[model samples]
Target: MTDETDQKDQAVEKEAEEKFPIGGCAGAHAEFRKGNFGTFVMRAQPVPNIVPPPPIAAKPLPPNDEIYAVCAKKEIGDRRGKSFPLMRRWDDGKLRPWDIFIARFGKQYFAYENACPHSGQRLDWEKNNFYEPNYMKVLMCGKHGAQFDVETGVCISGPCEGQRLTSILCFVDDDGDVCLTGINIDLDADVEPVKVVDPNSDEVLENNGFKLQSTKREFFK
Candidate 1:
C-alpha cells in the first residue's frame, strides 16, 4: 500500500485500540462510534424495598392465654366459647398490648389483631374491641374506615383498598376455644398499638370503652 494510505490505516487501528482495549468489545465500540463513550459506565443494581417480614415465632396454644387481661365467657350462639386477647406491656409503662378481637360471626369465633394495616390504626371503636353489626361479614377499621373479612384480614375499603390486615394465625382448641398459633410475643413495639389523644378536644384515648381516655399519666404526657 502507499505510504499515506498505510499511515491512515495505522491511525485508524490506533483509534480503535484507544476506543476499546478489550478484544470482543461490541458495546464499547458502539458507544465510541456514537461519541458518547465518556458517559457510558456500568450501573449499580437496584435495591429492593428491604423491609423485612414480621417476626413470627412460636405459636400459642388454644384458648389464647393472656397474662394481663380478663378471661370472659365469650359466647357465639347456642355454643358458648371462652376467649381473650394476649396483652403485652410497652416501654412507656402503657398497657398497649397485642390483642385479638374474638367474636362469633356465623358458626365459629373469628379473631384478629386490633390494628389496621393502612395506618396501623386500631380496627375498633374501643380498645380490645369488636363490632357485631348486622349483615356484616368483615371487621371494620374505625380510624381509616377500612373493613376486612372476619376469616381473612383482607381490607375491603378505605386507603388500603386491596391490602389485607396483619393476620395472627390461630386455631381452635380442644375445648372449641380459639388461640393464636404463630405469633412472636416479643416481636418489637411497631406491631403494637400506640396511645393517642384527640387532636381537637382535651379528651385522651383511654382503655375505657367511652370517649376513651388514658388513666396512666405517662401515657398522656
Candidate 2:
C-alpha cells in the first residue's frame, strides 16, 4: 500500500514538469508541485553622490597716490597755436595730454579724448585751442562750436546738445604739474590715434590730432 502511494506522487510530479516545461519563470505564477523548485533573484545596488566646495575671497587693492611728469613751463599756459597737446606726467614717467581749456581755467586740469564725440573731429579750433574769446569760463569745441563746463566737462550747448565731453581724469602734482592716476595716456606717449572716415567725402582722418608734431618743453624752474 505504501509503494503504491509513492508511485502515485512520482507520477503526479512527472505530469506537472511535462506540462510547464523550461522558461516558465517569466509568468507571474510559476506552476510547481508543492516545494519542488527554488527561485533565484538578483538586485541592483544604490549609487553614491559627490559634492563640491565654494570659492575663496579676493584681495583688496592698494590706495592711490598722485603721479607726475614734467610738462612745459607754467608761463607756456595754454598752447593756443601750439602743434601738440600738453600733458600731465604719470608715476611711471609717462605723459598724458590735456582735454580741458588750460587758459580759461588755470591749474585745475581736465583730460579728454581730443576727438569731438559728435562729428569725430578734433575738438580744437586751430591747434591746442578749445575755447572762445571769453576763455575764462567754459570750454568750447572747435568743430560745431559745442560748449562744455570748464570744471565738469559737461556740454552746455551747440550741435552736441545732450553730449558731455569724454574725460580722462588726472590730479595735479606738488610742483603744480598735472598727474594722471588713471589708465589713460597722452596722444604723445602711449595710446594709438583714433581713425575715422568723413561721412560726406569719404576722407579718412586721424581723430587723435592732439598728437601733432611738437618739441617737448620743460616748465619747472
Candidate 3:
C-alpha cells in the first residue's frame, strides 16, 4: 500500500515515546499518536516554598504632643539598685492607674510618684518593691516606714517627714527610649504639653495612653 501505511505511521510514533516519558513522575499519563504528538502536559505535583512576612516598620509615633516611650534604654541597667514602673496615660478621657517610680541614680534617672506623700499609700511595699529589703538604699515605704531620697523624693524618715516624691521629667530618647518630658497635668504656660527635648538631657526638656494592651506590670502577683 502507500509504503505500508507510511511504515505503520512511524511505528506508532515510536511507541508513544517509549511509553509516556513526557516529564512524567507525578501521576504521569501522557498520550499521543492520533494527530502525531505535539500537545503538552508535564506535571510534578509538590509545590512548597512560599515566603512572605516582614513589614510593620513605620514607628515614629512617640509624640502626639509630648514624650511617651517607656522602655528600652538598655532596660534601665546601670545598676544602683535598679527599679521600674513608669506606665503613664494622664486623662485623655479617664482611666488613671498612674505610677512613675523609675529610680537608678548613678547615671541619673529619678522619676518617683508611686505615691506616698505620707499615707496616701502605694509606695510599693511589695509589688515591684520600693526598696527596704535590708537596705537597698532607702526609698523604702513598703506601706509605711517611709524613707524616700533615692536622689530626692525627700520624705527622709517616715510619716511624710518633709514631703516630696512627685518629680517626673524624663529623658533618654534618640531611640534609647524612656521619654516622658511634659504634661502630666496642671496646665498653664500657653496650654502646657509640648516637649521633645533631649539635648543629651541637660537642657532639662522643661518638665514632664493606653487603650487595650494589657501588660499589668509584667505579672508575678
Better of 1 and 3 by TM-score: 1
What is residue 200's positional error in candidate 1, in angstroms? Answer: 14
1 or 2: which has the higher lDDT?
1
CA lDDT, every prediction? 0.51, 0.49, 0.53
The best candidate in terms of lDDT: 3
What is candidate 2's lDDT per residue for 1-221, written digit by digit as tens? 89999998777656655545454443214433454453322223456576666764432222245343534336336523122244444555545443332332554556555666678666655445566535436666655667777667777877776687666555566676654454433434543222223333322222223222222222111
Q: How accurate is candidate 1 locally (lDDT)?
A: 0.51
Error of 3 at 130 (Å): 3.9
Error of 2 at 21 (Å): 36
Error of 3 at 8 (Å): 14
After superposition, the stretches of candidate 2 with alpha carbons farther than 4 Å from their true spots are 1-104, 134-136, 184-221
Which regions of candidate 1 are displaced past 4 Å? 1-96, 127-129, 132-134, 186-221
TM-score of each: 0.44, 0.44, 0.26
RMSD of every prediction? 12.2, 15.6, 17.3
Per candidate, the number of residue pairs that clash is 4, 3, 4
Q: Write the per-residue lDDT of candidate 1 for residues 141-163, one digit (tens) a residue.
A: 65545667667768666678788
